[model samples]
Target: MTIRLASIEDHAALAGIFLSVRRSTFVWEDPASFQLDDFASATEGELIHVAETAENGIVGFISLWEPEQFVHHLFIANGHRGKGIGRALLDDLARRQPGPFRLKCVAGNSVALSFYKRSGWAQIGEGETDGRPYLLMELSKTDESTLSSPST
Candidate 1:
């Protein structure tokens, strides 16, 4: 797979992945509440990167609020998880932006929480959104150093 900045042509596919992944992963949320247009709104004014494969075209995406070095979204297409697509998108972003980045993960999503933790993000705080609790995570400048170093 290859990772690159998302083009306007990639939006439709990225939106589909966003909608589908959220619908499937956030089981507690009403799937019908997720709309294709939600992608445009959520990612507006942000920098987005997409993961593409020769066969799948676009399999995943990540969006960052560059002004704050905040990662707003990261989703892999269903059937494409566990393939390192998400990590590649993240590593690409880190290489390009060199972030002390922050993001929020829904507290109920254990899999995602674990992924972030294993990714060198630490829980710095917590907050609620739409009445649901979420963990506030950050990859600090200190933590970022380790992301690039060889794991012994």
Candidate 2:
């Protein structure tokens, strides 16, 4: 898979990938909440990266709000998970920023919680948003060693 900056032409495809992955993963939520227009509007001006395949076009994407040092979104298409695309996108971001990174995972989403923990992210806090419980996680640049270490 090839990872690169997302272009204007990639917006629609990225939106589709975002919607599909989110709908499947967050099955407990209403799918209508993941709207394409809202995604397009919210992601505007963010540092968005896309993971693509020569044959499949764009398969996954990661969007970061550099100013806030937060990851606003990271989604890999349903059929494309477990292929290292998520890690590749994250590693690319880590290399670019080399600083503290933060993201939130829904409380019941064990898959996401596990991935973040395994990637060296520590749960820093917990709270509820939109009536759903979530965990706030962070990974520091000084903790790079844990990035490559096995998940405890």
Candidate 3:
């Protein structure tokens, strides 16, 4: 798989992944609320990177709110989780922005929380969004080990 900046051509695939993942993963939310076009609205003005494979095409994407080094979203397609695609996308982002990056993971997403912990992100705080609780996570400036290399 290769990670690169998303193009206009990649938008449809990105939207699909975003919609499907949110619908499947966020059980606490009304799945019907996540629309394909939600991806474009949510990620507007952010820097986006996509993971693509020769066979599977676009499998995942990560978007960053650059000014604050905030990670706005990271979603992998339904069949593509736990395959290092998320980490690869993050590493690619670090290589590009060299961030002390931050993101908010829904409190109910234990799977995602585990992934973030394994990736050297820590729970720096807590907050609520859209009436749902979330854990504020951060990868500190010193936590660069996972950002070291690109995975295949």
Candidate 4:
């Protein structure tokens, strides 16, 4: 799979990927509530990177709002999970912003929670969004050295 910055031409594909992944993963949310136009508007003016395969087109994407130091969105297309695409996208983000990174995972989404935990993110707190509970996670730059140090 190739990971690269998204271009204007990629908007429609990216929006579709986001819709599919979000619908499948966040089943608790009303799927009908997620509109393609909303996804496009939400992703506008952000730093987005897409993962594409020659055979499958755009399979995943990660978006970051640099000004806010937040990961606005990260989604992998249906049937495209567990293949390291998420990690590759995140690795790209870390390379670009080697500072504190933060994101929220819906509390009941165990798959996402586990992935984030395994990816070196620590849960700092909890909150609710649209009435759904979420865990606030962060990967601090300082934590990197701590994570690499030999445990004594």
Best by lDDT: 3
Per-residue lDDT of candidate 4, residues 88-109 (tens digit): 7877677667669999889999
Better of 1 and 4 by lDDT: 1
- Candidate 4 local lDDT, residue 151: 15
Task: Output the lDDT of residue 106, model 4.
Answer: 90
Q: Which of 1 and 2 is ahead in lDDT?
A: 1
Could you give the C-alpha RMSD of every candidate to the true structure, in order shown? Answer: 3.1, 3.7, 1.6, 4.8
Best by TM-score: 3
Runs of candidate 2 exceeding 4 Å displacement: 142-152
TM-score on alpha carbons, each prediction: 0.92, 0.89, 0.93, 0.88
lDDT of 1 by residue, 8-92 (tens): 9898898899888989999989999999989999999999988888897998888999999999999999999987777777777
Cα lDDT computed for each candidate against the true fold: 0.85, 0.82, 0.88, 0.82
Clashing pairs in 2: none
lDDT (Cα, tens digit) per residue for candidate 3, span 88-152: 88877776786689999999899999998998899999999888999999987544564657755
Model 2: which ten-residue window has the lowest total lDDT? 143-152
RMSD of 3: 1.6
Per-residue CA lDDT of candidate 2, range 46-136, in tens? Answer: 8998988889998888999889888989889888889887887888777778668999889999999898887778999999998999999
